[model samples]
Target chain A: MERIEIGHGSGGKLTRDLIEGLFLKYFKSPELHSLQDATYLPGFEKIAMTTDSFVVQPIFFPGGDIGKLSVAGTVNDLTVSGSVPKFISVSFIIEEGFPISDLERIVSSISKTAESAGVKIVTGDTKVVEKGKCDGIYINTTGIGDVKRELSPKFVKPGDVVIVTGFIGDHGISISLSREEFEVETEIKSDCAPLNSLLVPLFDVPGLRFMRDPTRGGLATVLVELSETSGLGVRIYEDRIPVRDEVRFICDMLGYDPLYLANEGKAVVVVDRKDADRTLEILKSHPLGKNSQVIGEVTEEKGVVLVTSVGGMRRLELLEEDPLPRIC
Target chain B: MERIEIGHGSGGKLTRDLIEGLFLKYFKSPELHSLQDATYLPGFEKIAMTTDSFVVQPIFFPGGDIGKLSVAGTVNDLTVSGSVPKFISVSFIIEEGFPISDLERIVSSISKTAESAGVKIVTGDTKVVEKGKCDGIYINTTGIGDVKRELSPKFVKPGDVVIVTGFIGDHGISISLSREEFEVETEIKSDCAPLNSLLVPLFDVPGLRFMRDPTRGGLATVLVELSETSGLGVRIYEDRIPVRDEVRFICDMLGYDPLYLANEGKAVVVVDRKDADRTLEILKSHPLGKNSQVIGEVTEEKGVVLVTSVGGMRRLELLEEDPLPRIC
Candidate 1:
């Protein structure tokens, strides 16, 4: 009867009792137990501050895990706004039955990733929940920093050049094939990696019109958002778009679009046509951007189009149905 | 087939795919994707920011919910030392087959709780994972704020008075009976509530030694922590500690001690005797504190001790095990 069970997560009276009786007693603080949506500081600027929790299933997929994804997800949020990545707090909700060896491995990866990106895990907290009550483990990370640069939708012009940091859908396809059973899967590794190193280098360059990581809905979605945000149309050369043969093959077999498959280590940066070559060159030297390319150009047209390999043009549609393997 | 499922929670390829495909693309920024442990921001002070994902079952538990618990858990860490609660970002990992009505209810509760404590939900992200792949639903809330206040261990005083707001053990026992069939069942309500209104009002007061909310490990754990932190012993009166009849009945039947129970709507304030009366008065009038009382005193004895009803003293030992009721 005293044993912990899955029911504790019921959000019922029992949940509260556990929090109030045991957890809260030790974590005591008025602001903490205030139980608000967001903690109130009584002072903040006109800027936006946000935190996100991530629990991606695998610790290491083709591209990422709960750890790296947790970090990348937060960084991308700040990056698009021209804000620099800053300090982060990492908390792990480890199940009692989780493998300690795996955790150590994950932590080492996290440490290495943070070091490469030049951020620090200034503080950390850990909690162990009973098995079945949680997945193997969940990682929640929060980040805060200053937005030193100014980025606006206005900077995106109709004549801008649309450049991608590297190949699209590698991370998604790699992960999908790795996690699930599939035929015609390729030997592609995930494109999961950090982009801040490239981001800082790019900020010093001119004509950096717009930047976004094509993560979830992939290139199409990101392009759609930018077009909507910038009130501009976009056209792309399908032949020039970067996609590993493995990724393309898998997407074709599964009826998934590489354009919509996620990429952890890639990004879409819009720069002026004049600066595209320079930008591409700089990105190429970075390991994550070695496959960088100029896929398309921004336009004043009202819709998005892709030039087919046969020289025909087609409209790139918005995502309507869930492409489950899109994450790969 | 596109629905997010339990397998996606496996921390494998699909999880990576999900983030890269959906989450990363839309949330992309130049500063993100370094896949690091912590992000570095040069200007502001280094902050350890974090977000938590919770899917506690049985929404209307004896104490709180995934919503309230999410907020409390994050804020507690921020309030653990240098900072006050400032801003938070929330994300929802919802189960597709779960009840939308319940979701709405949880949202409303979260909003109300946040508003009451003056915190804003400012920004949030939502995603639908498949049924069973997730518990009913999971919530990820992240918070950030300034760490201007100095509540370090050095602030602890040897002769401080330990004031507990209202009762203990009720929250845990209530949840136990409500969530599961226990050996000795009793109907007891949880003390889950926000305590900032009471505590903030006392911030400007003098001789305010220290404060904590006895949550997971309850009063016993918190006192033990204080003893270690301040290098001072604590002496608490058994009679002075508050306990409700229902909680006592259930604990007695289960061979549980009320002192170690969790509390949401409670706090332990360490202050000098001079500020004790003023502190109690302020706490008594608050909605969360109808039965505030002085339960113990700090001592030079260097550990945790309880003055028993038989006029004999006993040491409060550390907890060796966890009381878990979890929802993945």
Candidate 2:
């Protein structure tokens, strides 16, 4: 049974062996082997660059592994930011003694995910630390994309409507249950996915002001940030926010709110009220966004207020503690 | 004294408090606070992007800490790629129960180093894992730079001269001693630094073919890689390679070759023979490169060979294994 050793990250023969044997074998791209310190990309006047480090516990989850989540996380960040996700750099810090077979599986997932999204895994690095110094592996991916439209909260106005692309909390709950720390079981799977194929086309819709994927801290944190940044209050209808029955059941049993659970494949969009219907129509046509709904609207006031299903308006404060840590 | 809890990385209120009180207080970049999922950088037709994950042990090391190394590592990667280092995205994966004061100290160091390099830490992410799941902290930085010139080994020919920017092995020896695992002591200082300001001017030099900072694998690995990539051999004079006496002594005591030790603030430049003298002179004028020297030349043969002080030629192999792990 071959396993990853500390020598694999020594930047010498073993490192080269690992790269050529595993990484290059999976990420076979010209830009990756271009023999330059930095991967060079030509022809882009303006660019959007974002980075995320994936530290999910139970590296292999129900629907996806760390590799898939790593690629999807960075790609979604760029896509939601109004950029056409093009190239990404993936770096891995693996703990020694990790099975090479698992590493290969993860790499294959990264390749498949990137190919499906039409994005290239152009550059990468791998480092192996001693056992106990790190968990199985942590992946940091930074994505660069070509800007297609302007998507900033600055364009979010008081009359704008807020829309959610799909069901939330699946990823958070899936990762949480995978740990088996709570002695619970469910068939729920992570909503981990790349959204460029779904959201990039929406740039043609007029008045599309902002789009962001709810990952850590989930939907509530993003809405709060949007409110603070736009100086406009956000009011969401609790009934309108979509949640799967299984996810809702787990949240209720655990005293966790679905609003604060992470979603790897969901988008919170803000657009002109006149364009909300059109945006929802555009989103619903995609498989990932089949449950698209107008969940809220921007208000003239200055905080996030949620209208509960019981017909009571209450403040949805920021997530104060980590109910599910390392959900990534 | 408050320590960093898992909540700080929950992407919730504690995360916001840490960002506002610590990260924003230090980073203070407009792009960082622009309230966007991905930082937007405007206007660059062609760009170089590089990413490195720093997991140096004993986070605080002699001459430089993880903060300084994180900045310099990515910035130098961009610099050697013939790019003017511009923007960087930093992500941190910290272990829970880590001291907040140490984290702040690291953040402050990052601010100072980024400022000195004229690069912006435009975006960042923080995640905290359970205790013992990771080392104290690991920082990963991805740098984006504007290409100032085309510097690649494809431009190298048989007559190219190899020039090293400064003394080698100081960083490796310093870090090795800092660990104190072997009970060896030395006064060597890590040569970690940002070299764009020092090397950017040399783009004006005629026949500047390629440049690369020798980090993890040291000069031997760089030369070997250059040989394999350019299809040319490299021959270096052992006497001509500059190594500080303290570093050499420690290497000798430990039976390690100075050529294979890591160097944080050094570069191996490949230039046409006609421009070697001029490039060396330009580099030597900078304080960080006062020991700049031309130690080798590209040969028609096809491997990396070192001429020993005893007048025997021997192969300088790629770093076989990490003699000193976490040396950065």
Judging by TM-score against the true structure, name the best candidate.
2
- What is the C-alpha lDDT profile of model 2 across A1-328, one tens digit per residue? 3899999989989988898888888887789978466978876978988999999989999999999999999999999999999899999999999999999999999999999989887777788899998999999999999988978888989989999998889999898888876756678999999999889989998899999999998899899989888888999999999999999999998888899999999999899999888888889999998999999899999999999999999897788798999987
Each candidate: fraction of true contacts kept? Answer: 0.09, 0.84
Per-residue lDDT of candidate 1, residues A80-129 (tens digit): 55666655555555555565456655666666666666554544444455
- Per-residue lDDT of B7-97 in model 2, one digit per residue for the tens? 9999888988998899998897898988466878886878989998999988998899999999999999999999999999999999999
State in Å the error of residue B314, model 1: 2.0
- What DockQ, between 0 and 1, does each candidate earn? 0.14, 0.83
